[model samples]
Target: MSTASAHAPAASVAPPPPGPRTEPLLGNMRALRRAPLDYFLAQVREHGDVVRFWLGPKPVTLVAHPDGVRHVLQDNVRNYNKQTRGFAVVRELLGQGLLTSEGDFWLRQRRLAQPAFHRQRLASFASTMVEAAEELATRLDARCAPGAAFDVAEEFNHLTLSVTSRTLFGSDIGASVSRDIGEALARVQAFANARLTQLLPLPRALPLPSHLRMRRDLDMLDRVVRELIERRRADTGTHHDLLAMLMEARDEDTQERMSDTQLRDEVMTLMVAGHETTASALSWTMVLLSRHPDVRRRLETELAQVLQGRSPTVEDLPKLALTRRIIDESMRLFPPAWISSRAALQDDVIGGYHIPAGSFVLVSPWVTHRHPRLWENPEGFDPDRFLPELERERSRFTYFPFGGGPRQCIGNQFSLMEMVLVLATLVSRLRLDLAPGHPFVPAPAITLRPRPGVWMTASRPRAATPASGTGQ
Candidate 1:
């Protein structure tokens, strides 16, 4: 032995990161199933940044601090990939799409899909969004009387799915086809969410009732994709939709176009994520506004000044400051994609803890957005904090609802523009208020949508003057 260690005890490795007490083969699964968002927040508050969790025999290390999140998501992102069980569940629904695929394949697909969401594409999409909102407002007027209770969440979901159908497939997609896609996706999402919280989840190969139902829905989604492909192949005219972009894009290296299988996978991914997330985000924004009439009033005033008795355009987005801030604040409080995870490719250190190779690393916007050390009055709804002057001073990774870095959501700008136009058009023509005594607890599934949905009363607002959107 060396002189320094001749009489000393052999060096010992550090103990594992702290976590809630657990039982053999069943650690923390019950807690996670009962209320995952609350459970995650509690874990971070009690155990510090690097909290270890066990679901069954596997250990999951949660990196809750902003620096660690940035490290895994941005700085050394290649060292981690979406190979965790969480993403595996998403992959089961979305196939080998950009959200689940990794390495060279993901890079190639991302490049192929980039131009579909460019500025020009978004301008056309914006027109589709505003037109859809105006049509929805007209429908609501025909059916919803004063004080009539309606599920605004469901309405927003239907509207977003319609817009997505028109923007993704084509403007000619019929209402019946949109309804079929919506019904199938709803069942598939429920099945995926159920799989996420199961402790001893049975194999899908087994003939379980839920598994059989999910397979039917998956098959339906496949048929829809096939139909879209055949239709696009037959048509020779130029189009402004995602399916056309993917079909037309050629690889720089090989000059080869995407195959039918690749198109199917990307379409499935976009159909699920592009609409559901936007709808959830918009519903949450409406709920926040319902609780804060003053914020709603200010938003109306801004819309009046910017729009001036007309629907908002892509060019008017810059002038809608308060409208954008309200959306930002709502997302901070209730992000649609609340939690996401990745698998470590090798050993690494995060938040001063040893994260071993093969460790499952988790990050949650729900927790970090309310981190006391990073946010002031983090639970309170305050839109002013998102003003450019204040937002510039905050940490980059501190409030990542759409994630960050290379793998950040590819359709973020498209989603934001759609949301702004939709809000401007609807809030000026219709008013939605939460039904009295309705609870607002979020159902943390594949998306963080409200549980039992956001029930509200809808009515058209009568403007006192042509220039004012604030009158009811």
Candidate 2:
């Protein structure tokens, strides 16, 4: 036996984690459905980091502490698999793509896709990102006249969709196609989130109204993706986009290429993941910036100093520290992947709480990022908290907006770079102010999106303006 295995400590059994007051069988289902974010926050505050509740007969545990999160995501990662309720909904849409696959298949896909996201390769896409942002800025300039109200969330959705299409597939989805794909993706995610909250979800084949709608939306998306894949395959020219690279990727051991179905699944996964999450992040960031003008001033000042009225390049990223921090802080307050779940493949113990085999373990970046014990002013919008010095004092898992461990987001760097460039380019030209009476609130579906959308007015920044005095 290996020395590590020989000396490993034996597992010890412990009682389930403490939970809120519950009724027989039903448990916290009602509360979880009504307001999941508040429910999770309250549970962690009252029941400690590890909290347990029942979804009917099934047991669900929420792990909110950094150490416990580490134990589940890293230390004992092998014992946990993505076979939980949350992933089941994702699997229905994503199939065996990297986001929902497991075991060796996931590893091979990860390896094959890793090279496409290399720093050098991603650097080449910086211009594409900036160009997309510029195109949006020009359109917004024309449509959003001074003091004119518009839905920033909707605009961001379009901007991110265009960027993702160009970067991922080397094609523009255009205005009409972008809108169609955006609407279809929204319906699919809504259906999936509904399934996630149900104690006994109806099967997809049941032909319920919701199920039928989901089927239609899924079919619409599949058709669009399949068409894109077919066009890529038929093209003769060499293309550098992610789709082309993925099409050409071959396994080292077997020397095999991906099948058409595999390519379609991956394209769909990247299309959804690459755009939707980034759009959500940008939408929230714009809302926060509008509400916190002082933070906006700082961000604008940094952009001025770094870019001097020119478009930002990949080389300018290091100098745009505050821009990156704003995105980081925005994600902390409203993570794109707000919640994650893993089912235990073997019995385990985390933070002295027993996790039985087949038990579902939940981790919420929304809760952990705002944990009272972890942050001094957990709910405040303070980008400086992510500055290097303060960031080092916290656990790595404490602010996992992109998740952690081996399965951490493959597009993390790509997303970060994209956000920075887009924010810098747009904020340099126009300042987005919240529209009157918009009533913006977070709708934590599959992704944490803004409910009713974030309505805001865009106008050119006033030259040599004083700080707004809302400094962090």
Candidate 3:
């Protein structure tokens, strides 16, 4: 044992290679500022799979291929951490919760939270998802007008916000808090990605415009969470909702449970993450389906045949094949959580390439999911690509809408169930058409959002007129 201890690997490891470099101190910041996604994509095309760039003094390595990404996200995950500058912004709002925390803290929180979203629990939650979708359909039914454009982004935001709030808390949070949180999150994400924010010498504790708004959002969200927890604690009713489950959970080691502050962070993280990504997914789904009438018609037919004006139940989900296919195709085209990053703690060889210690390794789902080598006709929006046989033919990393590996999204199943129900519920009642002269520009932010918002006109299914036809 003593000899083995002495023979163990050296205490201090060697520093990694100072990856491919360019021009003055900060390389290509000016170009990256003009178009972030395009600039990043350009770097991948020029510098091969692993290219090193700088955000001011910091070195960022972009990994475009699946093999390289798998090394960072899965193979050597222990050597990497979520210590990115952008992740710091999220830590501010969410505290040391699962999304930002490392090691034991993250593991403990994940374990306790995991069971609350288990597949069996999700069956109950599916009802809430369908209920929210039904509300959206009802609203659209009341507002159907010919040739009038509606921002589908805003509508979907409302839908997901409602679903998240009702599920997390046993009651509704209304639209006001939901809107505030959305606006605040937008500011925080912009600040997180901005080069100017990175250049600022001040510490993160000091509030910038974005930081100030984020704090306000955190406070607002905290107040809501606190009140909900207090009310649940005081109530004698037995509720099996997520918040109640969290309240009852106790850590086995210390028998310690979540404190109010901890609860606030977890709830806020779920609300922001849950609402924003789902809304973006729904908006993109609408934009993609609007452009492809045959896909839309097929979706409508499937919903009509399977659901037939009835609200979608968990059992109905498997039968809603086309609806699921449509959403799967939409996600393939525009995954909300596009880019994810990890900071390496030590130099390592990943796929014959040397990755240096302290380098920010980017595993971009946006690039890998659509890589020409992995996907056939990668840019096309084809739902058939996700059909069982075709899916089996596709490469594993070729479709990562909710990501892969252990750090894969906990609410992935919940999100999918919510999306299918929402789409089926909405399409069952209404037909949406893209407004004329509107361009759907993909603006990649915290999620890949539609630049000007997804503008469309919705009419009752029977009153629906195709883009070319007059209302019947």
Candidate 4:
């Protein structure tokens, strides 16, 4: 729907919402560079829900209110497009993938890719999710030793990458291949993210060391993805996964076949977005669980009562209430996509503030999810806040970790299921304690990664865990 029709203007137009005073030329860029997350948090806290700030010469309005978030994400979504500097960085790797595509083209691609995430498909993949988690748990058993530390963040990344490769591309990616793909994706995204935050980013055409290395890494990823696409194209009804759907799906009206480029873009989009964001969520959940022993105990009790120490299935997801809640609450605290924005296609009003055409509106979950007006003990980890009754009492936009509306992350359920099963499997077998003296600061890159890695000591749980190891 058009923004003009969706939101009738009030009698008088309000000027851009109040914000920090700008400097001569740098604007709020310096402050943002200094502490990105804190700058966003402070903007919403100090300047009300509709906080305006300048990044370089450009003006940015952060819509921290749920009502405003709804306006931008769902109510008048058409008026906002993914024409932001951030998405441009994403296009460097994703091309015109669904995550970065806009308008009718995005609509067409969404229609084609939608079936891969159908309820039946996801349900069928539950065993795949649990089996992958079970493998990770078995591996962790060997790694666990009293007082020994390893990066659980890395472990989750490998697991999610494995799951994504298998489910999305119908390829059983070996651990070593998963590691290689994960590292290559990291390089490309890390470079893109660094360039995004630069006050004056160097042109990609330049053969700087970082740029050259990223080019190599991106080419490596492209070759791998293209091979998978080729393999699927030659398949004879052997696979019915996402890649096959994208390959075989025909546009309803025009009946246009998906191009090689479009297929590749969508495949990479699912791989990177699915793998990275889910890993971030699981890592944060692990940290939160470790910190909150009471909550962890409650979750353990729930899993014990619900699954009876067996592998979790899709049927068990509902009964694993606290397990799902922990994932929900953890994402609220450390949203992987910490920064999300949409360009104003035309003049619009959100939260009673004028958003002139061409300006950008940022609906950061990082800010909105932690808004004190919207959440109690905004910064504290509390899973019960997501209890069905409590969730029903709140506006949906208030807690959008996977985002919302038509363009919500397509892999949301896929990510959630992966997190729950992984959490259940690992928690049932092992205990992860934060390594002494390691900070929990989040490093905001493509995703809000656990900075410097979540170093943790893993040991066999002496309590709650079943003694049979496999938990028969």
Each model's C-alpha lDDT?
0.84, 0.86, 0.75, 0.83
Model 3, span 1-472: residue lDDT tens: 0100233333244223234455576565656556777776666666566677777677777777766766666766788899987677667667887678889888888888888888898889888888888888887777686777788898988888888888887767767876776676666666554523445545657767755765676676677778877888899998878898787888878888888877877887788788888999998888888788888777776766676567889999888887888888888888898887788898666534556678787777777767777778878988888879888886566677776767788888889989988988888788888888777777766677888787889887653232321110
Q: Which ten residues in a row have the lowest lDDT in candidate 2?
A: 1-10
State model 3's lDDT.
0.75
TM-score of 2: 0.95
lDDT of 1 by residue, 1-472 (tens): 0111224222233346789998878898888888888898898899998799999888898878888888889987988899988799899888899888999999999998898888887788788899999998887777567667778788888899888888887874677888888889999999888888887678999999899999998998999888889888999989868888889998889898888988988988888998999999999999998889878777777776777788888898887777888888999999999989999887676654667778898889999998888889989999999988899998798899999999999989988998888988888877778889778789999899998889888776656233443321
Q: What stretches of model 2 exceed 4 Å from their correct place? A: 1-12, 143-147, 464-472
Better of 1 and 3 by TM-score: 1
- Indicate the residue-level lDDT of 239 in model 3: 88
For model 4, what is the alpha-carbon lDDT of residue 34? 85
Which regions of candidate 4 fall more than 4 Å away from where they truly are?
Answer: 1-12, 463-472
- TM-score of each prediction: 0.94, 0.95, 0.89, 0.95
Which of the predicted structures, 1 or 4, would earn the higher lDDT when compared with the native?
1
Q: Pick the candidate with the highest lDDT.
A: 2
- Which lDDT tens digits does candidate 4 get at residues 1-472? 1223445464147566789878888888888888878888887778788878888889888888888888888988988999988898899889999899988899999998888788888887788888889998888788777777788999899888888887876667776877789999988888988988887888899999999999998898899889888877786766766777678789999999899899889888888998899999899998998999888777776777677768888998877777888888999999999879889888887766788888888988898888888899999998888877898999878889888999898888888888888898888777888999778689887799998899888777655653232211
Candidate 3 Cα deviation (angstroms), residue 150: 1.4
- Using TM-score, rank the candidates from best to worst: 2, 4, 1, 3
